[model samples]
Target: MELRDLDLNLLLVLAELVREKSVSKAAENLGMSQPGMSNALNRLRALLGDDLLLRTGRGMQPTPYAERLAEPLNEALRLIHGVVNLEMDFDPARSNRSFTIAMTDIGEIDFLANLMRALERVAPDVSISTVRKGESNLKDELETGAVDLAIGWLPDLNAGMFQRRLTASQYVCAFRKGHALDKGSITLEEFARADHLVVLAPHTGHMMIEHDLGRLGVRRNVKLRIPHFAAVGHILSETDMIAALPGRLVNHSIVPFNLAWAPLPIKLDPIPLNVFWSAKYHRDPANQWLRAMMFDTFSEGAPHVSPDQAVPLP
Candidate 1:
């Protein structure tokens, strides 16, 4: 269909319909009547010559055609919105902007509290929301403006994304404060002999430390596997199962559990913690401020371990 034939307003209806997935809900969001939303949907179907949405037991599901349009449509709308607002200057002190970030449970534990405290003093009107990072779709989410920033050990970001390294993190062995290993430096044999609790990231179903151990032909006696790092502290506090976690996550000042940590006995390269954003928002004033705030917060507060501290197994 020619651009001249299309109603730009219909694109807004389509975007809301795709997001809300229900005509009534989309209408409510757009402040239009249900009949009006249905009429808009009909117009969109005729324009595209495809069924955009279908009814399913779960709810309204996007058809293959609708799914194909979802990303580019959102990106286009975001760009248009950005262009329209390009002249407005961001005043952090007065603006009540909300930012959505994608990160792991570990990141929430290590970064959020401190960052919020800092923002409370400087950008009191701002709000924050967080979503879990999906391994496969993180790049798409950023590009589509679903999330403003992603923070973690995201090593495989897509080419067009911009990343700034926050710090290099190394694994540390953590257990209850009074655990035997806490009395002295842990040895490789002792570490391997202990029952362990491991984290398998929900999106990737991979455990970085386990993968590293496997490569070195060193395996731990893993007794439990969980999907969130937040559970590690509580589990380690009550059970004999220790965990290998990023050092920043076990810092006593931030974590509530009565835990003690030591450098891993086996050598592993430091993982680079990065803040990732799409080049699309690289120069956007609000986005730039948030990125700078994140960089400053993490770089100053999060723990870092130098490469010289990594100890090799015998």
Candidate 2:
């Protein structure tokens, strides 16, 4: 018989029949009817040109060919099963697996230090690596397991992905601690008058803040145009330049940088920061552990929706 004509399920039935050596016993063990098992035995005999098992004085005995095939068939099935299933347990303390996360510079500043500290305590042997966010091939990377997780404002990562909201964030004007704006409420006119430090972080939902400002016709004397949020805290602390930053970032920087922040005069929508993972790895033990760790570390009191409750984008 040609390989294409072979049914994998038939092989399973043949193996069970050969081992049990009784049609009724094999059918009962395999959850099949007696007639079905008998038909399968007939088909197996015709396919292999061997009786395989024959009724003898003791009940059933295998042909010499059947004896040779039995051990090899069981071994092949065992090997195939080993390849298909992953090790179910992921012991963080013992595992040396390295996980990679994709995020922006701001995410690195906000998450990395705390994440590393947590890792040090529980998963000393495990390591972490990070890749820059907004890569054009990021979707492919996540789907193919090149990146284990992604965090931050990833609006474009819809469909075939799962996201858990981390926090509700909004823009706030941040400046040095003793800056005039720190003492009182900020007005749109005063916000426009100050020399601004604008961050041009591409491929993030943060760009919407600039769009809203433009739509409102609020003008700023942009003194510096930077590409990342990592330097914003330092620059704002040393110079008179004030910048609009996510409230979480400003809060994170305030004590260290001696910076102060107030609500922006312009009304803006709250941006939801989230932790995202590929739907492909949603059930993976290691990936599930990482997702739980991130949620515990950064959810900031937000409600968590279960994977079953939270639907993946189409």
Candidate 3:
């Protein structure tokens, strides 16, 4: 069917329908009556000459054609919306828009507290939410603008994105304040002999600590293996275990947990922490404002985003 023959408003309903799947939920999401949403779906079906969604035991499921249309449709709408609002200014002070960011627990400790404090001084009305970095759909979420920004040492998000280096971090041997190796330099043999608290978070750059150490023939006497960094400070502070973690995290915890840290015995590449946004929303005024805020607040060394560096993502 020709584009003119179809009512453009129905496309909005189609987008919501395919996204929500259930007509009732779509109607609620779009602030329309359930019957009105059903009518729109009926119109869409008649115009498209296909059963766009079929009801089964698990509620409404989109047909293959509708499923295929979801991404492109959302992308087109996002671009149109961005263009329409391109000239509008984003006043963070007045905007109550909640931004969702993706980061690891270590990032929450190292950055979130300071970011929230900065927000309170300027953008008090704005709210923030966080999702873990390793979510399987993280890239898709960022591309669709569902996630505003992703931060930390995310090497996985390298392709099809705009990134700004926030700072450089390196692994440090963190232990209790009174530990034997806390006073001075720790020898490689000492690090190898000490009890280790290993953080085993996958899809994060922290895993490289073990890989790098092992490559250099340094074996850690692992006493405990945890899946996250949230409790590392507590565990290390109360016990004699040493954890090889990002120096920033250790520094941030030092005051509160009485932690002490020294450089790792082996030299490894510095972990580059970055703030990433999808190429799709790179031109979005709100996104641009947020990116600029992040760069201004956290960037210590790297150059800022320039027109020459804004590349497209797949």
lDDT computed for candidate 1: 0.82
Q: Highest TM-score: which candidate?
A: 2
Question: Which candidate order results from sorting by lDDT in descending order?
Answer: 2, 3, 1
lDDT of 3 by residue, 211-233 (tens): 87777677789999999999998
Model 2 scores a C-alpha lDDT of 0.82
Give the whole-model CA lDDT for all candidates, comma-separated.
Answer: 0.82, 0.82, 0.82
Ten contiguous residues with the weakest lDDT in model 3? 305-314
Ranked by lDDT, the better of candidates 1 and 2 is: 2
Q: For residues 1-314, could you state the per-residue lDDT of candidate 1 as single tens digits?
A: 67898999999998899999999999999999999999999999998998899999998999988988889999999999998877647888998999999887777877888799989988999999999866578888999888899887676674788998876667778898888888646888888999999888854213666678898988789899887777778889987878888777777433578887777787887667778999988888999999988877764444455555566866
Question: What is the Å distance of residue 281 in model 3 from its true position?
Answer: 0.6
Error of 3 at 230 (Å): 1.1
Give the poorly placed runs of model 3, Cα more than 4 Å off: 1-86, 299-314
Question: What lDDT tens digits, residue by residue, belong to model 2 across residues 1-314?
Answer: 67799887888887887889889999999999999998999989989999999999999888999989999998887887898885688899999999999987777776777788889998999998999856457888998999999887777786678988877666778899999888746777788899999999887768888987888787899999998888898999999999988877887898899998777777777677778889989889999999888866663422222233311222
TM-score of each: 0.68, 0.72, 0.67
Tell me model 3's lDDT, rounded to 2 decimals: 0.82
Shift in Å, residue 123, candidate 2:
1.6
